[model samples]
Target: MKERKIPEPKPLFIERMNRLIPDTNDQKNYWKIVKTEPVNTIRVNTMKINSEELIKKLEDYKWKLIQPWKNYPEILIVEGKTPSEREREILINKNLAKLEPGELGRTLEHLLGYYYIQELSSMLPIMALNPKENEIFLDLCASPGSKTTQAGNVMKNTGTIIANEVSLGRMRILASNLERCGITNTIITRKDGRSFCRKIKEQKIYFDKILVDAPCSGEGTLRSSPKTFLMWNPKTIKALSRLQKELLKSAFMTLKIGGEIVYSTCTHAPEENEGVINFILNEFKDKIEILDFELPLKTRPGLTQWEGKEYDSRVKKTKRVYPQDNNTEGFFLAKFRRLG
Candidate 1:
């Protein structure tokens, strides 16, 4: 028997990223992180168990739990590699928790819905939205339900959240995660997020807040999904940006006057981040405005000029999180408020 070797990601991916990232040191750091392993982190589902209680349970099981340095108190950084199959079985046999096969997901705690295995960066946009209890919310690109269930926890499962996804296959996963997380406030919808406005206007429905976790090239997630290195191209960024713009327009149209929308993506492409936001700012100058919010981790401001084209100055308020900054996946986030 032979041990399979992990293949090295293509250099072309890093070279292209270097050209796109403005800072020399940042570009170097980005490549460095992508080659390394992604962090093992998970969010404690407060809906099912509070952090203190969950921490006690995991600690009793001999698992080391540390809080992530970021402001999200509900999240805990797990130390130590995933246990072996025999060890996992022993833990389960002891009736401590249902032990799964992986580090975060296949755990007794996870099976009971005590925690959600999610990336650190994936939780940021929901933090920015700050969805409130009793308010109406929309997750425009929700699937696999990480953000959707996170929103439910934030709202204490008190508000109505429309979780929409265009793909039926993904919608099934989204529905399953929501059910597993014990999220009852969400109403799942199968519709193209780009046409959300037309679909919901018949009821004169509007949301108090929205989240557009737009689909992108997955550049930031190379550490976990190495195939992104082989598959990413400028054309992917361009096509996703066009779709993102339409989705943003739909989200804005369905949002109440005072409602806020948090736009985010896991890729480092400016075309999908600042470029799309800038284009919308120009087209809906009077209808929307960018809102600044803070994250505890270090982040870069959105680019003003990319490839000789200038973006709206307000786009500077937008944030870009890099793996080097926090040992997490790179992400772009911008908050916008409907003015009209």
Candidate 2:
């Protein structure tokens, strides 16, 4: 009998990660965690449900939920185990299957938008942004509206949120999520994110805060979407990085002098993360300031050097959340403020 072989990312991907993370043991752990499944975490929609009431309703189903933060009861880490074969033998004979871990999304609570099944790391961009009531916000490159809905929750549907996406199909999904989550303050827009920002800048309009959750090579999504291993390409990363830089430039232009912008991505590619931030910092010079912030999860600071390229020193304030460090998808987050 032949032994089963495990799958891994492309050599180029491995090589790049090795370069980014030089520690031999750390690299091994990184790859090991990347191949594992992420934990189930959901964000409670305060607009529609109280965290305690929702927890009471969910616990009746025998699901174990842990609220990682006392202050953030909205974030729930779900954990539950199915009965063993012997324990479930009677139910099996009775033709009934017990609910399992993946069934959270189909629950009544989910359909009612009482909560959103989002990755813990994916929710951090909004947490860091700390959206306030009655403030103008923009989610550039928003699709499927996860962060948009989260922002809507934080703002209690008071402020206006411009959720922009270029693709019509994705825009539809974004609209659906926003509607399902009872997010009334968001306006869906169909346009290239950079061009839309530039146009809005021409109108002399500015946002209080913006989120550029840029699309990238998606190497960080390996656990959820293994196909990213094959889809990873150096050329694609370069192209995406260029587009990200332009989007940041346009977003920066449309930001008020005291406005903040959170740039994030679900990719470990330095060129798309720190490299993009570096490009914007240099182009804008003193006009942009990288902000230092904190999160509930463990995070590493942004890389200052990769592939012989050096980024601005201020980029050290950027946060990098790896799959190994946290039981979630890999994510890069950088918060910025417009100074000039």
Candidate 3:
């Protein structure tokens, strides 16, 4: 048996990050550049089929399934041939003479609503929230419905979910995704999540759980989509952080006492991840408590002491998943519960 050498973090890049974030040393050995492969992950619609039945159905197609985590029974890491490979397989397996260009598009399961293609890392935040059946949940700034759809599936369509998005174009995509995923318990709203929160407060309404998957500089998603890194700049990170703080404040206000809120971002920047969570905890110190949600997989906690800046001790409860460690997009998630 041979020993495998662990990859080390890039020195120059890490040094720069240390300058930007004092606690860089906490993640020194944990960071590394890893190849990002586009994976097609599907969340089973438990509302429509249980995990056992879904696995049985997918097994018919000989799709290899990997059970990555426990809490999510419907979650599976599937291995299948590429689009062209699947096309050929379908023709041979189903005895079809030739595959039409739209055959995959017109499949009954897809049309009738069976599953959704989502990034494994993108799905982590919603899974962390762990929405229960019949609970009221809101996806602040939800668009394209990846997290929204996942939350809906988690609730098994028994809860009320308000999926809010500011962009009309993105809202349409969200609606379409919900339709395809057969998610009917959600109300799609086109309004700034901050404003929506104010209205909910005026009406004296509160949500059981809220997800503030805030907009960020998208630095963590560079490997998943290069466009993110192409547009990244120091100024953009600062600007997005300001908006994220406001959104977090609103989300905090709209949550009922004893309810929980999960804050997450795809960016690796601390300004958006730990910084935002730190701000919220300080502002609402007496009203909320940080909940340490355990990850099914191993991960690093937020830096306790970074670069001469003392972050709130609560920041230690946050989780960070590096691309090199998870073989997925970089992500950060922190769950907080409202106190009476």
Best by TM-score: 2
TM-score of 3: 0.82
Worst ten in a row by lDDT for model 1: 92-101
TM-score of structure candidate 1: 0.90
Residue 145 lDDT in model 3?
90
Off by over 4 Å in 3: 1-33, 56-62, 82-108
**Candidate 1 lDDT, 103-151, residue by residue in tens:** 5676688899999989989989998889999999999999989999999
Question: Where does model 1 exceed 4 Å of error?
Answer: 1-12, 69-71, 81-101
What local lDDT does model 2 show for residue 203? 87
Ordered by TM-score, highest first, the candidates read 2, 1, 3
Whole-model lDDT values for every prediction: 0.85, 0.87, 0.76
What is the RMSD, in Å, between candidate 1 and the native fold over all Cα?
Answer: 5.0
Off by over 4 Å in 2: 1-6, 82-102
